[model samples]
Target: MTHTPVDQADPPTPHRDLHSEQGALRGEHPGRAENPVIKVADLAWLEFEKPDLDRAETFARDFGFAIAARTEEALWLRGTFAGPPCMVIRRGRASRFIGPAFRAAERTDLVRLAAATGHAVRDIDVPGGAKSVSLLDPSGLPVRVVHCGEQLPALPEQEPLLLNFGTDHRRTNTTQRPPREPSRIQRLGHVVLETRSFLRTLDWYLDTLGLIVSDFLFLDGQRRRGPTMAFIRCDQGSLPVDHHTLALHLGPGTGYVHSAYQVTDLDSIAAGGEYLAERGYQRSWGIGRHIQGSQLFDYWRDPDRFMLEHFADGDLFSCDLEPGWAPMSASGLAQWGPPVTRDFLGANPSPAKLREVITALRDDNELDPARLLGLMKAMSS
Candidate 1:
């Protein structure tokens, strides 16, 4: 399908982000897209190297994960849902992100990917037994796709509380305290990353994992430069999946940006945030509805400063759905929230960060000076 830019003659009033109307604009990516040999279904778990496993495990529990396995060297964490471990923390001298693992759509896809890429397929000995093929993504991050894991049984779920509205009353009497407990995350929802080569990295993912674009965002006034970021989802055919299982943004560093997990509801998210706060965990940004996925969210900083999100009620799309295109601006991030934080925007300056921005400005393939300037202007606006 062909895609054209949305006309800017009469823009909508500044009430919310342009995702709803803009999400209707969908089509094929600009260039040739081959069908990948393997289709990854869901984000499995994230790997992290932390100096203190105890501290990391503590934060994970407060953020609503139950301990799946804990050894002297590593820890496996999961939510109430039946799945493999949602997070793994390994003891290391310094804290750093390891990367995320995905569950392959079919078990044979793992073998297919291994045969095609010549990467060795290894048998996993962890909690949910499986076979996996690991490959380095274009962003130079390790990506593992696993298959044939024993599905863990779902634990008890927190039932959604009945809310009373002015006109529509569902509940008869009970007021809600929401348990003052950890919001039981249902599953690992999505992961976001920042990479150097935007198009190259994006194409690599599409060609490797059979992922499709759910939405694309570009710097304002630079449509010709293509998109600077894309919220990508797996092609699950008639089955609806999250708006984005993974998203990539153009940036200097190739590292983990954040990972989101689905909680029960807004009450879970809010009360969970309160629990984290009382425990002295840092709230990054949230308690807002995002423009892209439309998930009600709250973010927090883990013990190692990794970004983790608690989200609920995200948009889902069938594989037949096309992608949305929009401008990437700070204001375009959320429908309702406090102003976008500098840290969330990754605007914090370091000598290395300054150099990365400078290097990006110098690399025409990465981003032209005009487009970079336009992005800056958009952020400021």
Candidate 2:
């Protein structure tokens, strides 16, 4: 007797409100590359060109970075972590963000990356001697992949204050007093950038440096088109790393948005924010827990108007987890915090921003009329 064959294909999985488990099923781009040139270890440092080195150093100190090295032409800022400096600010005619540098896992990775990108590996002229391969992203931002010969030794850091939780008391007699000082940044957490060619730039980093997306945010009504913002992290195999080492979002202009540093805890963020406010520095946003990374954050503006964040208790993910997809909205920014600020959103109208919008609309890049409208809707939503 002949038996009838039955189809055993599983039904399609439905997308959840918080995350989409099946990217391929939804016709979305996979968050990683099959064969990348190199897998970078972490973000080494961010470079900036500032006109006033003295003013920059003052802000750096106030923002909780220890001066790793200072010279007549440049200043190197570091955290308490034993690694490369968190930032390098060079004296220049104007104050602007130069770009970010990623640390390669091995010297051979740098060689492989250089060979694949056709860029020669050159020596980095910073505090620690290093070899780097420099390249420009699709949005014209300079990116460096460096393999450093020496690592900066860990410095003394402020300890987290003991606290009493629900039914669990750590401190019995001590008063709950955190010092009114800088939050004492532990390490650079992540950097966020705005780029006109978001997809191209995103693909470049994933393909070249082997970064993977931790989360993806798509504009309202533009899910089919693709994600407009991506929180990307380094691929460290089974080791859990920061939810985002770098984040990129599509915008009319290409520039730095903000950078985050890890602080001890909520008390540190609050006390540090108070210290900054007392010093006449502007608070952009925060003292709230973010939804994506689950980090308690406080954003402040430096003297030069660059935004930096003091964050703590961020999520970490291993390489096995798939990227989560969510809709982009202002309300979705944080789990608990004050309403998102206009300054943090770049909503304050400016002549330079107006000019950028006009130029981007007229250009041949990715920012189009519909895309811009979707972005605007996303911001307002």
In lDDT terms, which candidate is top? 2
Colliding residue pairs in candidate 1: none
Best by TM-score: 2
- Model 2 residue 54 CA deviation (Å) reads 0.7
lDDT of 1 by residue, 288-355 (tens): 99989899988888877789999999999887766666778888888898888877777777898889
Model 2 TM-score, 2 decimals: 0.95
In order, candidate lDDTs are 0.81, 0.88
lDDT of 1: 0.81
lDDT of 2 by residue, 1-381 (tens): 111113222234455334445533234667888888889999999999999999999888888999999999999999998999999999999999999999999999988998898999999887879999999998999999999999999999889888789999888867877789988988998999999888888998998899999888877766666778999999999999999999999998897999999988888889989988999999999789898888999999998899999999999999998988777888889888999998999988999989999999998877899999988887788
